[model samples]
Structure formats: structure tokens, C-alpha cells
Target chain A: MSKLNDWVEASPERERIYAQEKLIVDTAEEIWEAMDKLEVSKAQLAASLGKSKAFVSQILTGSRNMTLRTLADIASSLGKKVCVRLLDAHESNAWQSVDAVLISRRVAGFAEVEVSNDPRWSNVIPLHKESCKAA
Target chain B: MAYSLRIAHAVENISRNLLVNLYINSSQPMDEYHSGSSLTIWLWEGAEASWAEAEVGVMEAHQAQFRARLARLAEFGRLRVPDHMNSEGDGIHAVKGNTGLRAYGWFDRVSGRRAFIISHVVLKKKQKLDPADLAKASARKDSYRLSKESK
Candidate 1:
């Protein structure tokens, strides 16, 4: 951990920050897979991201939240694009539609973690507003 | 039973500076038997709070005191608190190789009992608390010697 303690530290740009955020939440396994497939190293990630190795350590160790754009740049470096979509509320459907949604979080060519990407939802969710309120 | 400590603030600081995407959040209570992915230990978190109950950071020396107390609880068959509070990954042992990190805390699903609830964005070992881990217990020996008056 750097001797720092706050997020007020100087940052390059918002676009970069957003990109970094997307990467931070990525699964370590996913990142490892992407890097392994592309033949990249932590040093290369830092060099491409224009950050220090120490900073890269923070990002990889879940110590940082890279912005969406920064994550996109990192992905782009790897030849990937972050993708997203929205699911609206349908009156006829059992589930209520959401007003707005933040669809895809892309990392250029590296990898993507999306709602549709994962297929591990096995539990049934009852569509009851009261239950929602209780939860 | 179990407790969840927030180390996100600390994690955020490190990531913003270093620029990495590793993050860990507790989706299920620590008591929930860890399956392939029960405890949410992700590398990033754009905005989803699925597994992350909160954030996590490295523990300070004093905070290590809390870990020791929590450990004593477990030693007496009470609750075992986790050693590395907000560390990412399964038991510290897995993270540290063989001379691995000591994975503390106990989990009991029979009644949904969790020791320490922890979530971490960064997974670095900050301080070595093991060196002085049991030092305090040994120091009090002189004072805890049956308390001459009580004997």
C-alpha cells in the first residue's frame, strides 16, 4: 500500500478513471485469462495504462477502482471492447421494468463482464413489490 | 457470531493511485460455506454491489488487537475472527502459498454464524502481526499467575 490514504490524490483524467473502475471489479481469473491469452505482463499493463507498477499493483490487488474509460483503454490495448445493455420493465411480465440501467462496461480488447455474459442464475426471484420492500 | 469489517476506503485509495482492478466483496455471509464462488472475490466493481456487502482495507497494528481478541474467542470455543480483515481470496493460506497467510475465523451454517464480515479491494499483506500476535498473552502471565491474593 502506498503511503497514501485518500482518493484526492492527483489523477490523469475522468475518462481514465472510469476505465480503471471497470477493471477493478473484474474477476482476477478473467484478467489472468486475458493476459495469458495475449501474452502480457503486469509491467506491460502499467506501461500501456501510463501508470506506475506500484499503482498497477493496487489495481490488480483490488486496491483501486479504475474508471470505465481507463478500463476500456486497457481492454483496447488488448483488442477488446466493453459492451452493455438495458432491461426495461414490462407490465405484462412478472418482473417490473427498471427506469434506467447502466448497460455494458467494456475494456477495449481485453475482456468483458456482463449480466448476459454470466449464466449462473439458478434461484427463482418472486416478483412482488412487497417482498422487494421487505428486502 | 460473525462480523463484517469495511476496508473499502483503504482499498479505493490504493487503486486510484496504482490503477489496478482487483476487488473482493462478501456476497454471502462468511458463515455460508464457500463454494466455487460463494464469497464474492472479484477483481473489479464498476457499480455492482452483488457480492460486495462493503469495502475493505489492510488492518493497522491496533486493529490487529481486534483480530487477537476475536481469535481468543475462537480458542475458547467461541467465535473465531479472521486474521486478515479485508483481504481478497479464500483463506489467507491460499493467498500466501505454503508459508501462507493464516486463515482465521470459523463458519457455522447451522445457525448462520459468521466471525468477521470482510470485503477488500486490495489484497496485499500490510503488516506482519504474527510476530507479536501472542506476545500480549505471554506478557500478562506474571499478572495472571493465580493472583496471589485470590490463591
Candidate 2:
């Protein structure tokens, strides 16, 4: 086993902590990206949320614990909505690849397709154009 | 004077051998097609030892935070946030954690694969990196280049 694997398996607590940290970092990145797209500054976000600029800075830096309520508030302040999904361990990294495949299939005129067996492309079903038109 | 010169050469050889043996910590498949830009991460054995030391000294939460940041870098090729990583000029960059843990390294392209080879690790005590640390990392990068050229 590699040293990284050993470090990962050293303690279950480490994994749990890592999960929390990843969520915080990912959420912070998302907020930062949204702010950049919306042309919102830290001071502006703070004004929208009626909070202090330092609080927003803390959120961006992942130095403060961001609860679901805070996340929703931040998203609303930025004129965006929060999306939360619980994905399986395998799907977490593979979902993007599956999405890309579905998009390519649509572009290639394969309106309807089913992907299975392959874990990377698993659990994705592309909707047919007829079905979309009917809807 | 000749004997002293020989002793200096022997010491250099021992240090060179030690530097040549690196303890890598990457989980990416080198040849796999990744949807995201994937870069392999490499750490010198001494740097790894320093990381282990930092892991032992910090809180478990901080250690996990550091690992997760590294995992993101390996998975995504780059950290999206500048706060997490940014170039320090002169080809040296740093991977930073919220708790002030940092790994100083540079990017390399080897065999058509991009890699981030960590030359050193530090638990930074200041908001800005010390110039001495940057110089050491830069010197190590030069040594790495020389070693590769000799090969």
C-alpha cells in the first residue's frame, strides 16, 4: 500500500473530517465563482445578507462553519439558488463523464440512450427528442 | 587538501542519493483518460517526512483539511481558488491550507504528463512566505533540473 493509502486508513475520523473539509472548500469555491459571475464583491454580498464583510470573507476562506441556512442565504444574496445532492462514492467523480457522454450522444442525434454496466457511465438515461416534444 | 576534496565529494554523493529517492503520494491512474485535467503529485522523501511530522503536530481536523486540499489538486489539476494555491513567481507555487500548512513545489512536464513535484513543506507562521523558503525551493528545483539533465 502507498503511504497515502496508509494515511487515509490511519483513522476513520480522518475520512469524516476530510469529507467536511471538502464540502466547505467546494462550497466556498462555488460561492466565489458565483460572485465573480454576478459581479458581486465581498462588501456587496455582505450588504445583501445584512452581514459584515469579515463574515463573508470568513465564508470564502473556509474559516467559518457554513450551515445550510447560511448557504441558502448566500445563494439568495447572489441571486442564485443552492443545489444539494447526495451522491454515492462512485458516482461522485464519474457523474461529469456520464453527463458529457449524454451531451455528445444528443449532439450525434442519438436522442435516446441508456448507459449501464460501466460504473463510469452508469445510471444515466438520455431523453428522446420525441419525448421532449410531447412534454 | 586532496583528502578534504574527496570527503566533500563523498558527502555530496550521499546527499544526492537521498534526494533521488522520492516518496510519491498520488492516487491518479497515470494513463487513464480523466474528464477533468488531472496532474500527478510527487513529493520528495524528506518533504513527505516533514508532512508526516506536520500531521502529527496539528489537530486531526487540520490534517484532514490539508489532505482534502491535496486530493482536490490531484483530481482537478488545479485548485480553483487562489487562496488554496497560487504561483509565487520564479516557477514556485504553493499549496496552502486554511490552517497555515503549505507545500512548496513547481510544475514539471515529464513523458507527456504534467506533475507537481513538492520540494519542501512548512507550517507557515506568517501571512506571507519567507524569502528564504522560496530561495530554498527554487534551488531545489534547479537541482532537480540538473539531475534530470544528467540522466
Which candidate number maximizes TM-score?
A: 2
lDDT of 2 by residue, A44-89 (tens): 9999999999998888778888888999999888766765557664
Tens digits of per-residue lDDT, candidate 1, A17-119, equal 4333322322233344466668887789889888887776655544555666766776677665544333342221122111101121211111222222232
- TM accuracy, model 2: 0.69
User: What is candidate 2's lDDT per residue for B1-151, written digit by digit as tens?
Assistant: 7556655766776565335332211321122111222555777546776766655668878776776677666655667577788898899999888878888888886444567788778888899889987998898888778766766
C-alpha lDDT (0 to 100) for residue A114 of candidate 1: 28
Residue A81 deviation, candidate 2, in Å? 2.3
Clash count, one per candidate: 56, 0
CA RMSD per model (angstroms): 18.2, 14.4
With candidate 1 superimposed using the best TM-score fit, by how many Å does residue A120's alpha carbon deviate from the native? 19
**In candidate 1, which residue ranges exceed 4 Å CA deviation?**
A1-23, A27-29, A85-135, B1-32, B36-92, B95-151
